[model samples]
Target chain A: MAKYLLLKHYRGAPAAVNDVPMDQWTPEEISAHVQYMNDFAARLEGTGEFVDAQALAPEGRWVRYDGEGRPPVTDGPFAETKDLIAGWMVIDVDSYERAVELAGELSAAPGAGGKPIHEWLEVRPFLTAPPTITE
Target chain B: MDEALLRSLTPSVLGILVRRGADFAAAEDAVQDALVEAVRVWPADPPRDPKGWLVTVAWRRFLDATRADAARRRREDLVDEEPAPGPAPAVDDTLQLYFLCAHPSLTPSSAVALTLRAVGGLTTRQIAQAYLVPEATMAQRISRAKRTVSGVRFDQPGDVATVLRVLYLVFNEGYSGDVDLAAEAIRLTRQLAAAIDHPEVAGLLALMLLHHARRATRTAPDGSLVPLAEQDRGRWDTASIAEGVEILQAALARDRLGEFQAQAAIAALHADAPTAEETDWVQIVEWYDELVRLTDSPVVRLNRAVAVGEADGPRAGLAALAALDDSLPRHAAVAAYLHERDGDLATAARLYAEAARKAPNLAERDHLTRQAARLNARRCR
Candidate 1:
C-alpha cells in the first residue's frame, strides 16, 4: 500500500524550535545534517517506490492572485499557527511498518542546534478512488 | 445456441479457469471472453454437459493469455501449477474465487469488478455499461489492482470485511438501466452470506433486503424523491421486511454488534413502522448512535442527525449538523434536508441547489434541483 507523510513540528511546534539561535551550532554540523537528509532521500529515490517528497518553507504568506497587477499579499516569519503543516510526501511502500521506519529516519535529521529534534510526524493512509474500467 | 444451457454453465467455466492457476481477476476476464464466444457459437450445437464444455474452452483462453504476458512471471512457470481437475472440482471453487476477488489490497472498485466478473458471471461490457465509465479505464483499474496484489499469497484465506465491502459496493451501484445492479448485489451478497456464516454477513443481507424493500416507494410517480415521511407504506415489501427482521433478530441475539448489525437495527426499526408518523425514531437514533461508536464515519454522523431530527425536532438535527465538518460530501445536502424540515424554505432551497451541483450522479442532481424548484414554486403560490 502507498503511504503518506504528515510533516509537522515535534517540541512545542516549529516556532518554538525555530526560536533556538542558529549561531550556537558549528557550521560543519549543519552541513552534515543537510547532507545526511539529501543522501537518505537519494537512497529512497533509487527505488521506484520513491513517489514524491519535498520540504515546505517554514514561512508561508496568503496572497490574492485574483487581482490584475501584482495581486495583493501579506507579510511573513509566518505566525506560529495551531495545526499548521510544513509539507508532505507520498511514497509507495510495501507496508505501514516500512513507512514508519522511513519517517523515523527523516525525523532524526539534525537541526541547527546540532541535535535531532525528531519531530513527531503523523502518518495517514491515502484512500484512492475506484479505478475506471476500460474495454 | 441454447441460452439456458450457457447460463447454467457460467459458474463452472469460472471454476475451471480459477483452478488452472488464473487469479480471480484473470479467471473472470478469460471466462467472460469464452462466454461471449459461447453466446455467438453454442446455439448451433449444444454440447452434453455444457458446463464441462465451457470449462475446457475458458481454461485454454486463460492459459494462452498467461503465457503471452511478458512482464508477469507466468503461473505456468511455477513447477507445481495444478492441472485442471475433471468437471466439478472437489474444492469449493466459487468460495475460493470470492476470497481472491476480495483480496485486501485491491480497492473497493477493483474488488467489485473482480467479484461481479468472477462470481456474478458478467461480461466486461455489462460491468462497463453498468457503471457508465469508459471500459478502458475500468480495465486498467482492474489490471493495476490485479498487478498490485500479484505478490499477495492467494492460498491464504481472506478477511471477511473485505469480502463484505466488495458486495456492498455492488449493491450501492443502484440500477441505472436494465442491469438492476442493486438486485445483482443482493444476489451476490446472498451467495456470500451462504458461503460464510458471519453474523455481520447475515446482518448485511438483512440490511440490503430491508432497504430494497422500500426502494420502490423512495421515488414518487413523477420520479422525484419521495421523502420517507411521504412514502406509501403499503408499497413496501412485507415479505422482505419480515425476512430482514427475522435475520436481524437472529444476528442481534449473538451479542456481536458490528457495523452491519447496527445498520440492520436501524433498518429493522424502519421496517416495523406502518406509517412514517409511527416510526420508532428514538430506537432508530439509538442504532445510529451505536453505528457512530462502531464506525465514526462522517456519513454515519449525517445519518444520525436525520434520526435525531426525526425523534426530537429539526433544530436538534441542525445542531448536530453544526458540529461536523462542513467539508463532508453530504453535509450541505443533509443541512438542506434539516432546514426544509425546520420550515426555512429559502435557506433549504439555496442549500438544495448547492447540493444538486455536487450530486454524484445526474439522477440525484435532477432530484435535488426539482426539490429546489418545487419549494420556489410553492413560495410564489
Candidate 2:
C-alpha cells in the first residue's frame, strides 16, 4: 500500500467553487462542513486507510542555525500572511487511483450553504522504504 | 523452562488443533492458554516432550472451550475423530500455518500481526508494545486477521512470496519494546526454510542472516545511524556471516536465481570484505544488475546506482542516476553521497539538508541533518 498526503491550503491554492469564508457561512453550514470533514476521516479510519490528520495554526517563524555561542536566528515574516497550509490528512491506500478518489471525496466537504467546496487539494505520495524483494 | 523452546512449538501445535477441526480463532486461543499453562507449571515439573505436552494441553483447552459454548457445536461433529495425541502427525503443519497467516485476503499489517501472534507466538500485548499500538488496537487487528483467514481450508496451497514478504517486514522493524523483531523474523524464516524446498525461501533466509550479521554495528551506542562503509567490520558477527554465506552458496547452486538470492549475493559480497576498500563492488554491481532485471523496481535501480558509483566512479554513478526519478526515497541521500565523493561538498551539503527535511522517519532525518551540519562546519574552516 502507498501513503498519500492530502493537503488543504489556507490561501495558496486556487479558489474553490464554493469559496465563501468560514466566518461568513451560516453557522449550520459551518457545522455541516465540520461534520463532513470528521465523517470523511472516520470513514477512512474504518477502511484502515487513515494514517494521520492534523490542522496547522498557520502562524510560525523561520529559525536557522547561527554561529556557535550565539542564539539561533529567527526572522521570517508572519507565516499567516503567506499562503499557508490549513490542514492535511495522510492516508495509506491500495493504489494511486484510490488515493486520488479519497482526496476528491475529502475536497468535496460541504462549504458555504452546505454545498460541495470543489477545492483543489494537493495529493502527494510518501516515499516508501525499499522492499526486501524487488525482483 | 526455556521460553523460546515453548514459543517454537506454538505454530505446529496450533496447526494440529486446526487440522483436527478446531476453528482457527479457537485453536489460537487454546494454544495461548496452553502456553500460559506451560509457563506456570513447567518450572516446577518440566515435560519430557514439550510439543506433545502442549498439544495435549491445548487440545483439551479447545474441547473445553467448544463444550462451554453452545454456538460452537460445529466442533461436536469432530469429537469422534479426536486425535489420540502423543505427538503431532509426522506431517509438518507449520508451513500451512505460515500460508494461512499470510493469506491474500488480509492486508499487510493484518498479515504481519497474525503471523506474529499465531506463527511467531507473540502475545497481543507484546506485539502491541513492539508496534507501538495500544493493546486493544492490536487485539482487534489480530482478531480481524484471524477472522479473515478462518474460511480458508487448512490444506490449500499458499504463495511463498507473500509469506516471505511478511517475514521481511518483521525483520525490518528491528527492535522495539522488549521484542527483537529482527531476531524473531530470522527465527521464522529459518523455520520456513526448513519446511520448504524453494530456493527463494533459502535466499530470503540468507539475506536476513547476512543483514543481521552486521546489525550490531549498523548504529552507534547512542542510537545514531552509521553508514555501512563507516561501520566497524570487527564488530560484525563472524558466525552469522559464515552461516549466511554458506546458505547463499547452497541457494545459488539451485540456479533458480530469484530476487532474494540476488540480494543475498550483494549482502554476501559486503560481508566478504575485510575492509570497505576490499569490497568487490564489481560483483556487487552485477548482483544489483540481476536484481534490476528481476524486479525492475525503481528502488532497486536507485540502489544499483550506488553500487555503480562504488564499482565505476562517482561520475558514472551520477550518469546512471540520471535515468531515475528524483522523487524516489533515498534518491537525494544517494545523490548527496555521490556528490561528496565527486568533491562537490556544497551541493552535497545542500542536498543532505533537503533530504533531511523530507525524511519520513526521525532517525534518517537526524542522520541526514548531521551530515549537512558536518559539511557546513567543514566549509566554515
Candidate 3:
C-alpha cells in the first residue's frame, strides 16, 4: 500500500464554497464539524487506512544560515497573506483513486450551518524506499 | 532454557498443530502461547523431550480454543475422533509451513512478516521493533496478513523463487533494533536448504554469505558509505568467504545455472581478489554476461556496464551505458564516475550534483554530495 498526505491549509488556498471561518461558525456547527472529523479518522482505522494525523499552530518563522561562527538569521511570523498549513492526515491505501476519494470525504467536513465545507485539500505521496528486487 | 533450540523447534511444533486439523492462524497463536509458557517454565523444569513438550502444550491450547468456539464444537468432536499422525510425519510438515507462509496471495511485506513469525519463531514485538513500527500497528498488519492467507490449503507446491525473494528482502534490511535480520535471513535460508534439495536455494545462501562477509567494511566508523573499490580488504571475513565459495562450487556443479548462482559467482570473483587492483574484471564481466542471459533485467545490464568499464576502459563503459534509459536509478552516478575517469572534470562534477539530488538513501546522497564538492574544489585549485 502507498501512503498519501491530505493537507488542510489556513491560507494561500482558493476560497471554499462555505467560506466561513471556524470562529465564525455557531457552537453547534463547530461541534458537528469536530465530530465529523473524529468519525472519519475512526472509520479509516477500522478500514486499516489510517496511519497518522496532526494539527499545527498557525504561527511559524524562517531561519537561514549565516557567515561562519555567527548565529543563524531568523525571521518573524509573516502577515496573514502568507501560506500557512493548518494540519494534515496521512493514510495508507490500496490505490491513488481510493486516496483521492478519502481526501474528498475529509474535505466535506461540516462547516457553518452544518453544511459541507468543500475546502480544498492538497494530497501528496510519500517517496518510498527502493524495493530490494529492482530486477 | 536453550533459546535457539526452542526457536528452531517452533515451526515443527506449529506444523504438528496445523496437521492435526487446527486452522493456520489459530495454530500459530497456540504455538506462541506454548512458547510463552516454555519461557516461563523451562528454566527450572526442562523437559527431556523439548519437541514433545511443545507439541503437547500447543495442541492442548488449540483444542481449548476450538472447544470455546461453540460453532466448531461438532466439528471438533469429529476431528477428535481421528488419531493424530505419528511424530516424524508431523515434523516433516515444516516445509509445507514455509510454502503456506510464502503463499502467492500475500503481498511481499506480508509474506516476509508471516515467515519471520511462523517459521523463524520471532515474537511480534521483536519484528515490530526491527521494522521500526509501532507495536500495535505491526500487530494489525500481521493479523490482517493472517486473515488474508487463512483460506489457502497446504497441499499445493510453492514457488521456491518467491521464498528466496522474501528472504533476500529480509537480509537487505540488515541490522535494526535488537534483531539482526540479515543473520536471521541466513538462518531461515539454511533451514530451507535443509528441507529442499534445490541448487537455487544453495545459491541464495552463498550469495548472502558472500555479501555479509563484506558488510563490516562497507561503511566507515562515521557511517559514511564506502565504495566497493575503496573498502579495506584486510577486514573481510575469510571464513565466510571460504564457506560461500565452497557452497557456490557445489551449486555450479549441478548445472542448473540460476540467477542467484550467477550473481554469487560475481561476488566470489570480487572476494577472490587479493587487492582491488588484482580483481579479475574480465572474469567478472564474463559472469555478468552469464547473469544477463539468466535474467535480462535492466539493473543487471547497468551493473554489467560498470564491470565492462573496469575490464575495458571508461569509453567502452560509457558506450555500453548509452543503450540504456538515462532515467534509471544510479545512471547519472555511473556516468559521473566514467566521465571523471575520462578527464571530463566539469561534466563529472555537474553529474555528481544531479545524482546527489536523486539519490534514494541518505548515505548515498551524502556520498554523492561529497564527490561533487571534491571535484568542484579540485577545479578551483
Candidate 4:
C-alpha cells in the first residue's frame, strides 16, 4: 500500500463547479458537508486506510533567519498571491486508483445548494524511504 | 529478566505450538501471553528450562483458549493430543516461522509487521512505535497477516529470496523507539544462516554487517548525511568489517554467487581501503558488473556508473550514465557528483539543485542543497 495526501486548497486551485463560498451556503448544507467528510474518513478508518486528517487556518506567514543571534524576520500572509491550503487528508490505500476514488468522493461533499462541489483536490504521493537494496 | 533471551526463544516456542496443531494466530497470541507472563514471573521465579517452560505455558494457554471457545470444541480432540514437550527441532521450526511470516500472500508492510512480531519477537506496540504508526493499526496489520497465512501448510518449503527481502527491509528501517531493527535484522539473518546453508544468506549477513559497521560515521552529530567518501574511516567498526570480510570470502569461495554476495564483495572492497582515495574502484566496478548481470536492475547500473567515474574518469562515468533512463531515482544526484568531479561547476551546481528537489528523504535533500549552495558560493567568489 502507498500513502497519498488529498489536499483541499483554499485559494490556488481552479474554481469548483458549485463555486459558492462556504459562508454563502445554508447552515444545513454546511452541516451536511462536514458530516459527509467525517463519514468518509470514518469509513476509511474502518477499512484501515486512514492515516490522518488535519485542517489549516488560512492565515500564515513566511519567516526567515536574520542572523545567528538575531530574531527571525516575518513577512505578510500574502493571501492574494499565496496558494493557501485549507486542509489535507492522508490515506494509505491499496492502489493509486483507490486514492483517486476516495479523493473523488471527498470532492463530492454537499455545497451551497446541496450540490456536489466537485472541487479540484490535489493528490500527491509521498516519497518513501529508500529501500535497503538501493546501492 | 533477560529480554533478549525471551525474544530469542519466541520463534521456536511459537513454532512448536503451531506444529502441535494450534492455529497460527492463536498460537502467536498464546506465545505473546506466555512472554508477558514470563516477564512478570521470571524476575522472582526464573525457570531452569526456559524453552520448555515457555512451550508448556504457551501450549496450556492455547488449549485453555480453545476449550473456552464452545464453538471450537471440534479442536478439543487435537488439543487433547498434546505432543510431549522435549527437545524440539528448533532449526526447522524457526525457518518455517520465517517463511510463514514472509508469506507471498501478504502485502510487504503486513509481511514486515508479522515478521517483526512473530519471527523477531517484538511486541505490536514496539513495532508501531518503530513505524510511527498507532498501536491499533499495527495490531490490525499483524492479525490480518496471520489470518492470511493461516491456511498455508506449515511444512511447505519457502523461497529463500522472499525471506531475505523481508530481513533486508527490517535492516533498512534502522533504529526507532526501543528496538534497534538493524541489529534485530542481523540477529534474524544470522539465525537464518545457521538454519540454512545458502551462500546468499551469508552474503546478506555480510552486507548488513559491513553497512552497519559504518552506521555511526554515516551521519554527523547534527543529523546531517555524511557522504561515504567523507566519512571518518577511523571511527568504523573494525570487528564488524573483519567479520563481514571473512564471511564474504567464504561465500565467494562457494562459487554460487548471488546478488547479495556480489553486493557484499563491493562493500568489502570499500571496507578494505584505509582511505577513500585508496579505494579499489576498478575491482568495485567489476563487482558492479557482476551485480548488473545478476539483477540487471537500473539501480545497479546507476551505481556502476559511479564506480566507473572513480575507476576511469568522470567522462566515462557520464557515458555509462547516459545509457540509463533519466527517470530513475538519484540519477540527477549521480550526474551532479560526476559533473563536480569533472570540474564543470555550473552544470554540477544546477544538477545538484535539481537532485535536491527530487530527493527521496530529508537528509539526502539537505545534502544535495548544500552541495548546490557550495558550488554557487564558489562561483560568486
True contacts kept of 4: 0.21
Q: Write the per-residue lDDT of candidate 3 for residues A1-135, one digit (tens) a residue.
A: 567899999997789999998999999999999999999987776555677889999988889999999999999887754689999998866578889999999999999999999999999876553332221
Report the C-alpha displacement of residue B330, candidate 2, in angstroms: 1.6
lDDT of 1 by residue, B1-381 (tens): 654356445655676665566675577677887888888877787677677667777877776777666337634464236474476675555565677778877766667766776677776667756755445544655566667666766557878888887777777643465567777877777777776788999988998888888888876677666666787889899999999889889989999989987887887787788877899999888888898899988889988888898889999999998989988876778889899999999999999999888775555677788888988999889
True contacts kept of 3: 0.05
lDDT of 4 at B269: 91
- If ranked by DockQ, best first, what sequence of candidates would result? 4, 3, 2, 1
Between candidates 1 and 2, the lDDT winner:
2
Where does model 1 exceed 4 Å of error?
A: A1-135, B1-16, B20-29, B40-50, B60-87, B343-350, B373-381
Across B203-229, the per-residue lDDT of candidate 4 in tens digits comes to: 999999999898888889997888889
Report the C-alpha lDDT of model 2 over B208-284, residue by residue, as the tens digit. 99898888887789877788889899999999999999999998997899998998999999989999999999998
Clashing pairs in 3: none
| Angstrom error at residue B105, model 4 | 1.4
**Candidate 3 deviates by what RMSD?**
3.9
Candidate 1: tens digits of C-alpha lDDT, residues A8-110: 5522344533344445667887787778877776666543235556667656676555567775766554565555666666655556777898888777777
Residues B21-103, candidate 3: write the lDDT tens digits: 78899999999999999999999999988998898888878777777773555555544644453453534777888888888
CAPRI-style grade of the A/B interface in model 3:
acceptable
When only the first chain is scored, the TM-scores of the models are 0.66, 0.92, 0.93, 0.95
Fnat for each model:
0.00, 0.02, 0.05, 0.21
User: Which 10 successive residues of model 2 chain B have the least lDDT summed?
Assistant: B70-79
**What's model 4's TM-score?**
0.90
TM-scores of all candidate predictions against the true structure: 0.65, 0.81, 0.87, 0.90
C-alpha root-mean-square deviation, candidate 2: 4.8
How accurate locally is residue B14 in candidate 1, as Cα lDDT from 0 to 100?
73
